[model samples]
Target: MRFKPLPADFYLNNTVEVARQLLGKTIVRNYGKKILAGKIVETEAYIDKIDPASHSHPGITKRNKPMFEKGGIAYIYFIYGNYYCFNIVTERKGKGCAVLIRAAEPIEGIEYMKKNRGKTKSVYELTNGPAKLCLSFGIDSKFNSISLRSSKLYIAEGKDENFDIVTAKRVGITRGTEFEYRFYIKNNPFVSKSK
Candidate 1:
């Protein structure tokens, strides 16, 4: 079935709430005649100041300006000097909140993702991590600050099957690790790092 991209208003909510609710959403990337799509399976919420792990905690910088924009934009960032991570700007304008997209289950363009990832092993290896997911879907710094409501890159509604949603501490972080801001589908093999 065809699904419409979610409206900006759908992201203008509490950061944590938005993160939890995004679990079953579909992330779509249109590349000319090729389309890459996946079901969001893992996410982490970050609220400016309130969440010590957030990039906005230390105030806005050139790198994190997108997170300060109104919800429904991409907050792509480079990490480990090797991989790009994707996030969805959330909350109201200037709030500097976002939901980190940690992992996804490939739904379309699996061949493209496999080619991008250079992996022929298993589907789980293609997008089972933040960096992997970004690479698999061809997400990079170029997508930073882009609107999620746009045609090229957007989020669509997906199945809300009877899967249990689990919450845990954010991973690979030094601060705010105590906050249970990380969410994922229980028993889903696509989760980046399951607890």
Candidate 2:
């Protein structure tokens, strides 16, 4: 069954723990009269200066200001000059920690996602990567710093009963590549570039 949107307190935990706990959460996007939802299957943690892969590693800037906010806010950013990536601020305010939502299994509004992504091949193609998921859900830089508890976009609880989660080195990065911060559901086909 679908759950109510998560509260801001739900994100006020350690960065890594938040990433792990988000494994089965449902990310909901309320666009107009339609609802776009997906079950989070993969995530990666960026912990302050300790994690060189994090944008806030060098301290807060205009672009990464949202990362310095309290947990439960969006930190959407543009990359490759072509796609936008979505991240959720984690930990307490001024922690500069966040969790990158790497992938998710499409659940609701599959048709809307398919149309947004211009994809019709398979469900997996709808949200198999950070940028891809944002594209599929119509998220962009404009969403940066928005409250996750808002009705427009929020994360809801899910069937996090017993899904096996595996941790591995984060992908598509050069610095801080040795940290095994990436977490994904074991055997989940929706994971982005899983091993």
C-alpha RMSD for every candidate: 1.2, 1.4
Query: How close to the true structure is residue 117 of candidate 1, measured as C-alpha lDDT?
Result: 85
Clash list (residue pairs), candidate 1: none
Tens digit per residue, CA lDDT, model 2, 1-195? 355888778899988999999999999998789999999999999999888989999998998999999999999988988999999999889999999999999999999998888745688788999998998899987788999988888899886478888999999988999999999999998988745
Among all windows of 10 consecutive residues in model 1, the one with the lowest summed lDDT is 1-10
Error of 2 at 189 (Å): 0.9
- Write the residue-wise lDDT of candidate 1 on 29-52 in tens digits: 997789999999999999898788
RMSD of candidate 1 to true structure, Å? 1.2
Assess the local accuracy of residue 99 in candidate 2 as a C-alpha lDDT between 0 and 100.
Answer: 95
Lowest-lDDT window of 10 residues in candidate 2?
A: 1-10
Error of model 2, residue 98, in angstroms: 0.3
Cα TM-score per model: 0.96, 0.96
